[model samples]
Target chain A: MSEELKALDVAVEVDARGTACPGPLLEAKRAIADCPDGGVMCILSSDEGTIIDVQRWSKKMKHEYLGDYEDDGYWRVFMKKTA
Target chain B: MSEEKPNLEEMIKQLTARVDELEENAPGDNLSLGVISGDLDYTIATFIIALGAAAYDMQVDLFFTFWAIASLRDPKKKVKKDFLGKMFGAMLPASSKKLPLSKMQMMGMGPPMIRSVMKMHKAKSLEELMKEAAEFGVRIHVCTMSMDVMGIKKEELIDYPHMDFVGVGSFVDMFQNSKQCWFM
Candidate 1:
């Protein structure tokens, strides 16, 4: 999964590190508005809730949640704006 | 003989109609929030949940009553009021920024400490969350009866984009139509 995401073309990358709960998710929602449909978006977050929050947000918005990868102290959550 | 025996097609038709009715009666993608506390922590939590739900594509309504109404007061706006109204205004928190924390309030030290922590974590402040909530189309309803009891005038409230002065009955109607109800 990490290898797949690494090769995927991400149109937008939101850096939400050091933000608290729901902050990263909110950032992703705002950034995804500019991302074209079917474009992959990446969110870098250090919050612990980002992993599940992104997945749930993606599902609710009818987007495709590509999953997350841990790097150093932060995480990279990926999603496709299919909706 | 036909009158005595139940027809399969007719039974299926009846069941389908019943299912349709059930589906129509189910609650929709809406959330009703009862905000009764004026404490900074509770107020923040209320907006966080409301904003999150709004982002999830849910129609969100926040009904502010009693103490929570103080959080909506505009600090910069001054209005003519009776003695009682002035007293109430002086007693309650001036605005969201002036609200106290619910616990560990050591002579008003807790709020600032928590605020700094929030800033350090890059969490949106209460004002920012409220603005974002309005931007997300979250409806804010202030309780008419509570406002009357507290001697708060509509002009004294913040100029939120989607705010309205409403009665408890209106909130009840909203609550009944919502898929979920939260009391904070």
Candidate 2:
């Protein structure tokens, strides 16, 4: 929420809008995997099933899922990196 | 400090040489992953890609977008053709819906009928298969924007372990770091 907090953390953003099913989510996972410890990756999507799929994915990966958000007709998913 | 060690320097050199040998033979860390992004044009493609990646022991992620997101929908949707046609085409509607996607190998009736047969045989449904794949560590994602366009609700989706929702910009960032990216 605060810039200071953000400064102390690394973040990666993945844009998966209209990309297609599975393709985008798979990309997001690979991104999160490459991130350094204590980093977070955010994914943007336009798929309806993501609400369930991405949440389940983050859970399995043992990453922190910050829920989903809508931004100018796009979805924003924030994932915190862990190992 | 031993009173007198027998060839302490020689022993140290031998140990160091062995350590160096082990380090040289040890594998290094290099994790590579591939990503796919497409709609229905990607259903079969995504599955094949996942199977291959899983075989190679590479971590895979399938992010569903738009029509493709429906790929993760209820396997019941698999037999969809509306009430008019599907009713006549199906014997046991519920089982027909649970057939395996890959087993539906009919020429015109190939994929559909194979699914029907798989359903009759009590094969694992798409959701079940995807769940098992996730247990193997596959990550499946869906898009929220498509949800709005399709007028679908999240609660309608199945609860699976390898699923998630994200944004486009986020995917772009993912692309920057991925070893490989596929349009399927």
* Structural similarity to truth (TM-score) of each candidate: 0.64, 0.43
lDDT of 1 at B60: 96
Docking class of 2: incorrect
DockQ of 1: 0.01
What lDDT does candidate 2 reach at residue A73? 74
Give lDDT: candidate 2, residue B168: 56
lDDT of each candidate versus the true structure: 0.85, 0.56
Q: Which stretches of candidate 2 lie over 4 Å from their true place?
A: A1-83, B1-42, B75-110, B114-128
Top-scoring candidate (lDDT): 1
Per-residue CA lDDT of model 2 for B1-184, tens digit only, reads 5744767977998999999877754433212222233222235446656656676776666655554544455433343354543443242212223323433334335556654565799865444555556777767656565655454445545566766666453454344434566655
Model 1, B38-143: lDDT tens per residue?
Answer: 8999999999999999989999999898999999999899999999999999999999999998897789999999999999999999999999998999999887
**On residues A28-58, what C-alpha lDDT tens digit does candidate 1 reach at each position?**
8789999999999999987544675577567
Candidate 1 regions with alpha-carbon error over 4 angstroms: A1-83, B1-17
